[model samples]
Target: MVIKEITYGGLSREHLFDRLKGYPIFLNEFAEMLLFSPHFCPSPQQQSLSVAEITVGGLGLQQGGTLEEIRKQARLLGLVECPLEAAFYSRFYFTDQEEVSKKVVNQNPPGALVIYSKPLLADRNFPRGLYLRKIKGDLWLRGYRCSDDYVWSPLDAFLFQVNASSRTLE
Candidate 1:
């Protein structure tokens, strides 16, 4: 599906990161929009748009109230919670045990992950962009997105899952 381009406009990197630190979905949506819609701007009348997203972290997939944990973490670091205006709901997935800790050793990190890597355009920087809960069953990445927001192929998802698993092994 066609998406819209992200208009960072006057937003600075620090501002973006600061906004994203507490709300990972903002970054996820931003990336998705940038990738899909390099130049997408709907008419002002197009108010309802579906957005799909995938967030992988300690928690596995998307779950409700996950943002509170993210917000808490950001609060600890003196950040603010992201507003609903920044994003919308889509889909969520929780990683299985095999994905959390791998038996094989690789260049990936060790933990649950949901990552995707593309060319210089979009790449999943696992373990780095990822944040560990430091505890189990606490939900890794606390975010969600709508289905229309993402238009991923099976190969894309598989490759990302594989890479994410590698990170857990590390």
Candidate 2:
């Protein structure tokens, strides 16, 4: 699979949101809480990253498991968690929402692209993760909170950071 390289940083949170004006984004309550929380700090310096989009099945968890299991599988497969800023950058750079929506409409599947990063605690200390999905022609930047026992689906797509030197899985 081809890896996508993107540069992130050098912009304030408000500026980043302003840049996403033309693009559609829907933030859920959890997402809003997380974004406004003190924990959602973006990097100050610019950094280039190589990222990969893969499915839970691609991580060798056909039946899926909890987040901990998912992370372990990703590490074993030579994938690393993305930084928190990656969620913002990925949503900003992923301009092909219409195409993704088309595919979801035709395929009739839940097409959400989740950015795998260190889970941040939102209100009430809920662990939140960011995901992007286009529904009814509207793009959504949603946040989800799942328990430790929650089992992810095999078809669930995840975006992860790829080490530049280690492209091939172990």
After superposition on all C-alphas, the RMSD of every candidate to the true structure, in Å, is: 16.8, 4.0
Q: Model 1: what TM-score?
A: 0.23
Cα error, candidate 1, residue 145 (Å) = 26
Against the true structure, candidate 2 reaches a TM-score of 0.83
For model 2, the stretches where C-alpha displacement exceeds 4 angstroms are 97-109, 122-127, 165-170
Question: What is the C-alpha lDDT profile of model 1 across 1-170, one tens digit per residue?
Answer: 11222222233334444544554333344344432343323232223322212232222323322333433332333233211222211112222323344332332234433222112222343111222211243333322232222322221111112121122223
lDDT of 1 at 46: 20
Q: Can you give the TM-score per candidate against the true fold?
A: 0.23, 0.83
